[model samples]
Target: MAGPIVSRVSRVSGANGSSAAPIFVDVDTGVDDAMALAYLLASDDARIVGIASTAGNVPVDQVCANNLGLLALCGADVPVSRGSDRPLAAPLRTAEDTHGPEGLGYARLPSRDGTLTDYDAATAWVKAARDHPGELIGLVTGPLTNLALAMRIEPALPRLLRRLVVMGGAFDYRGNTTPVAEWNISVDPESGSEVFTVWSAAWGLDRPTHLPIVLGLNLTENIAMTPTILSRLAAAAGSATTPMSVLDDRGSRSAASNPLIRVLEDAMRFYFEFHFDQGEGYLAHLHDPLAAAVALDPDLVRYEQATIDVELTGTLTRGMTVADWRGHWGRQPNAHIGVGVDPEVFFDRFIARVGPYAATLG
Candidate 1:
C-alpha cells in the first residue's frame, strides 16, 4: 500500500556550489562491507551522513561494532546506529564462514572510542532521509530488515528519498550463499520481499517511473579483487609521493606504517583463500564495493529494467530472487538491474579513493 511513484533522476553532485554528495549507508560490516565504507570515506565527492548497522554477515551488535571500528579507522565521526537484531520473520542466521568469526576476516580493528547514536537504525534512517529529503542517497549492503522497519514507520519513505541502491539478489547468475538464493535476500526473504514490493509501488513499475537500482551477483561478480590489483594498491600505499602516504603523519614511507592498508591486506589474504578453495580463481568478488560505486555514479554500470520479486515459500527456492527477464509475468519493472560493468573504470576509481583511506588506518 505505497503511494505514487516519484519520478526523478539521481543527482550525485551537490546543487550549484554545495558540498559533496550526501550519502547514508546501511551495512552488515563484513569484509566487503568494510571495503565499501572505505571507498565512501575516501571519496571526495561523497559526504557520509550516517550508517545503520544490521544483522547479516554477523550479529547486530557485532555489525555495529565493526561499523564503528571502520569509521574510527577512517577518522570519520559519522553517526552510527544499531539496527534489527534479527530478521522480520525468520531466526537470525549468520555467515561466519564467509566473513570469518568477527565478520572482518583476519582484520582486527580497534574498539571505537565514540559511542553509538541514541537513535536506533530505523529512526536514524527516517530522520536522515527526512533531513536530507531529495539530497540523500540510500545505499544498503545488507539484509533489508532495517529498511523494512523504517518503511513501516514511514510508509512514504521511498518518495521522501532521492534514490535507493541495494546490493543483493541474483538475476541470471549462480548464488553465492545457496544454489538459488543470494545471501542478503536469503538471510531475510520476508523483509526483502516487503522492501521490493513497497519500493516498486513507490516508483510506478508498470508505467516506468523512478526505479531502484539493484546490483546483484550477475554484475558484481564481474569485478574481482585480483592479486595484481592488490599489488598496485600496496605500491601506491608505500609511495611517499602518493596521496596514500599523506595518511602516515609520522612520515613513514613504508606501507606497513598504514594500519588500514595492512588490515585490508590481512583480511584479503583470508578472502583470497576462501575464493581459491571454491575454485573461483585467486580473486574475491568486489560485491558491496561495486554496489557503493554504482550508488555514487549510476553510469558506471549498464542497467536494464526488470520486474524483481523474492521467493518466500519453496522447499529449495526460498529467498530466491525471481527476476522476470522474459516478460512472462508481465509485472512492472521494479528494478533497474545491473547487467554490465567496466571493471577497469571501477578499479581505477576504487584504488584512487579507497587506497588512501586504507593507508590512513591505525
Candidate 2:
C-alpha cells in the first residue's frame, strides 16, 4: 500500500505520559472498531501491542484487509493476527449493512499479503492473558465468537486476563439490529452464552476485578454524537491535512498530525453519515468508543458489579442482557454493569483527546 495520507494535527501523548501503551485489541474492522483503534493508536499511553481479526462486520478475509488498511492509515507498527474463521457453534454472520461491504465503509482498503500471524483469535486471547498474566487488558469490540472459541480451547480463558472489557449486550434499552437483540450478541448467541457461563464461573483470581465484563446496554446507546463534536473532529483533521504546521508541546505536529486527523475525520464522517442517512436525528452514538474509553478511564461511567446473563431463548429477548441490578436473585456478581455514565464529562474528554490527534489527519 502507498504510504498513509499525512496531516498536521497535534497527537495526544500517552494519557499519563507513560512510555508503553498496554492494550490488546480484537476487532472485526467495523467503522466503529476502526474509530476505537484510532483512539488507541493515536494516544501516547495506549500502545498497540497486537491486533487479532475476526469475522463479524465482514468475512474473515475482508476483516484482515480492513485491519491492515486502518493500521496503515494510523501508521501503526503493531503486529497483526488472523483469528477464527467461524463462530463457536452457530453459522457465521456478518454486518454488511452497518459496516458496508468492506466492513469499513467506502474507504479505500489496503491489499492483503496473507501474511498476518496465524494465531487462532481465542488462542491469541489466551496467550495475551498468559503473557501479561494479571496485568493485561483485553478489549473486545466485536462479536464474542473469537472469545468463545478461545475459552473452549483453553477452558480457563476468563482466568487468563486482568480484564475482559466488551462492547456487547443490551439492558434496560432497545436493541439496534433487532427489537431485543443487540447486533454483536444476536449475531452469535451460542458464543455469547458460552462467554457468559465461562466468565461467570469463579474459578480463577480472588479479586472480583479479575474478569468483570463491561456490559454496553443503556450505558452507550443513547449517548448522542453532536454536531459540535463532529465539527471539532473535522477541524482537527483539516488542520492536519494543511501544511506548514509547527511541532507543539503535545508532539511533532508535522510528524504525527496527518495520521491523527485523518483517522478522526474518517471515524467521525462514517459515524455521521450512518446516523444521518438513517434520520437518527442528526446525531450518532459512541458505542464501541465508549467501551474503549471506559477501559482507558473508568471514571467516565458509574458501574456496579452484578450477575449478568444473556437471554437466548426468548423470542423477543435473545441477546438481551439480564442485569441483576438489585441483587434480587441473590446471585454472585459476575460482571460489571455500567448503569450510568456522565455524558458531559465523557464528551468533553473524548473531544479533547481526539481533537488534537485529529489535527494530524490532514
Candidate 3:
C-alpha cells in the first residue's frame, strides 16, 4: 500500500477542531456500491471506521473479495467483515445481470485473501456502535440482513448510533427488481421488515433514536450518470482519454491511466451498458452513491418522514415497501424517505471530490 486514502483526504474539522465523522458501511459491492465507497474515500468529512460485505449483487464471499480488493487498491486500512450469505426467509439471489459477474461490472478488483476479520459482520456493527456510541453514522447500500441481525444481537442498536442511511425501496416509483419491490429490499424482505419495525420502536425509547434516511429508487433514479458525466469525470481527473459513446463496443474496458481510475471507468462502462440494454439510454442510475453522499451530509436530498413497513404476506407485493406518508398507520415514522433531489448539485459534488481523489491515486 503506497498511501492510505483516509490519510490522503484531508480531514475537515468542525468549528471546535473536531475530527471527521466516523462512518460504518455495509454493502454488496455492486457497481454503484463501489462508486459509493469511492465517494466516501474522497470526502474529507467522512472517516470510514469499518465495512461489512453482504450478499446481494453477488455472493457474500465474492462481495468480501470485492470490498477487500477495493480497499487494498486505494490503500485503505479499514477493517472488513463478512456477513450473511442468504436472506432470513428466502434463498439468496444475486444481481449478476445488473452488476456483472463479479458484482463490479467488467472491472475486477485486486483480490486480497485473509482480508476478512475473524469477527463476523454483526459483531463488527455491534462493536462499532458500542465503541462510538452516538457518534457512528451507519450506511447500508445492500440488503439489511447484517444490520437487522445485529439489532437482534444488540437490541439497543438503534439508540446507540447517531444515524443511518439505507439505499432501498421504491416508494411510489416503479421497482427495478420487480413490479413492486426494489433490489435491496427484495433481496431480503424479512430483514428489511424487521429493521423498520425495530427501528420505529426506538422512537419512544429512553434515548430517542433518529429515523434512518432511506433513499429509495424514487429519488436515486433521478441521479443518473451518462457518458457526458463520465467525460466530465475523466476531465476532472486530468485523464486525457477517449470519451465513451453509445457506439462503443459492449463490455469494452477503460483506457484510463493505471490503477483506480481505470478500474472505476471500466466498472461504470459495464453499468452504462446494462442501462442501455434496458432502454434507459447509455446512462446508469447511481442509487448507492447518492445514499453514500447523503450519509456524509443529510441536506443533499429533501426527505419526508414516513412510517415505513415491508409487505411480507402478499405473494405479489411481498418485499414491497409501504410508506405511510399521511400518518394513517399512527406509528412513529421509521425513516426519512427521500422525495426530492437536485441531480446537478449531487453530480457537482461527486465529480469534484471523486475526480480529484482518483487523480491523486493515478
Candidate 4:
C-alpha cells in the first residue's frame, strides 16, 4: 500500500493576519505525536522548519524513525535531527504500553530514505533559532532533554526563539505516570526544571516577558479523542476519493488511497484499548495536537501566569509540576500554564482540519 496521500491547500494566514508560523517541533513521536505532526502538516497556518527527536514514548532511535516516516507520509521537507537518548538526571523510561511496541501502535512506517542532518539535535536547534531569530516558535511534545541540551549549547536559545510551547506536566490533577508525576516531566524532571527556569535568565528579561506556555495534562486531558470524533474522521477518509495515487516529487508514496487513514485507524485500535482500560470512554486525549493548536492559535485555550517548577526530590511526589497558582511562591512567574480549554471548539477544528487530509491520501 502507498504510505499516505497529502494535498496542498491554499495557504491561510494566522489569526494576526501574518504568514504561516515557522515552527520547530521536538517530539517523541508516539501515536498522539503522529497526530500532532499530521495536524501541523495539513494546516496551511504552520510551516514546520525542523523536527528534533528525543526519548519519551520510545527510544530515541525509534522516535527518529517515526518522525522521518511521518514527514514522508505528509510529504514534508522538514529536517529531522536526533536528540538525547535518555533523560538528564533520571533513568530512561517509555510508554510502550500505551503506544504499543513500535510506539505507533501497529503502524510500521517505511525505513528512512535519507541521512540525518550533520548537526546533532542541540546544534540544529541553535542553528534554526539563530537563523530565524525572533521568528521561530519551539513546540516540545516530549521530554525536555533536547531543549535543555540546546540551552546548554546556546545559552540564549530561549531568548532567540519567539516562544516555547510544551505538551507535558500535570497541574493539580492525577498524573498518567506516577501518582504525582506526568510522563514527560517524570521522564526527566531535571530537564523540565531547566526548561522552565532557563528562558528568563537567558533573555535577561523580566519573568513575564519570556515565560514558556505550558500545556499540562490539566488542560490537555480535557481534549479527548472520543469515539464520535474518530468515527467521523474515519468516515470522511474512507468515503473520500482522490487522484494521484502514485509517488510525488519528494518520492513519497501517494496518500490518495487513504493509507494514512488506515494507518491511523490501526494505530488507534491500541490507543483506544489503552484508554478504555483507564475508563476514559475509549477516548485518547489529544495532548500534543492541542499543544500544536495553541502554538498556532493561542486563543483555543485560556492560560494563567504561574511560577512553575518540577519537583526533583520528593519521596512520593517527585517530578510533579509545582504550579504556584496562588501567590504563595515569592518568585516571579516564569510560565503561562493552560488551565482550561474549549473542547467543542477544539474537536470541531481538529476534525475539520485533520479529517480531510486523511481523506486525500490514497
**Best candidate (score: lDDT):** 3
For candidate 1, list the clashing residue pairs, or say none: 260-361, 261-358
**Candidate 4 lDDT by residue in tens digits, 1-362:** 22111211122243365678889999998999998898898787788989999999999999988898877776668899999899998789999989989899867676676557878887888989988787788899999999999999999888677778999999889899999889999999999999888875665444354568888899999988764576667666664322211121221222334677756655666677778778876668889999998888877777777778999999999999987766676666677788778998987787788878776665
Model 3: worst 10 consecutive residues (lDDT sum): 1-10
Q: If both were scored by lDDT, which would come out higher, candidate 1 or candidate 2?
A: 1
Candidate 3 per-residue C-alpha lDDT over 1-362 given as tens digits, one digit per residue, 9 for 90 to 100: 12111111112333344467889999999899999999999999889999999999999999999999998888888999999989888999998998999989999777674468999999999999998877888999999999999999999999788788999999988888889999999999999999998887766644323777889999999999988888888888988767789899988888877477788889999999999999999999999999999887877888776678999989799899998777776665567788889999999999999999988887
Output the lDDT of residue 355, model 3: 93
In candidate 2, stretches whose alpha carbon ends up further than 4 angstroms from where it belongs are 1-21, 110-114, 203-205, 237-270, 358-362
True-structure RMSD, every candidate: 5.8, 10.0, 6.9, 9.2
What is the full ranking by lDDT, best candidate first?
3, 1, 4, 2
lDDT of 2 by residue, 1-362 (tens): 22212111112234355555467788888877877886776576566677788788788888888887766655567667788777766677887766667766545544543367766666777777676655566788888888777777777666655566788888767788788778777777777777877877745346565545565757887577665665555555555233211121211122224454544444444555667667775456777777877666655666666667777788777667776766677666667767777777766666676767655544
Which number leads on TM-score? 3
For model 1, residues 1-362, the per-residue Cα lDDT tens digits are: 22223233345455445567788999998989998988888888788999999999999999999988877777789999999899999999998887889988878888786788998999989999898877778999999999999999988888777778999999878888889899999999999899989987776633353578888998898899976687677656663223222122321232345677766766666676678768886679889999898888888887777778999999999989988766777676688888878999999988888766566553
User: After aligning candidate 4 to the native by TM-score, how far in Å is the CA of 97 from where it should be?
Assistant: 0.4
TM-score of each model, in listed order:
0.90, 0.82, 0.93, 0.88
Candidate 3 — which residues are off by over 4 angstroms? Answer: 1-19, 205-209
- Between candidates 1 and 3, the lDDT winner: 3
Residue 26's lDDT in candidate 3? 99
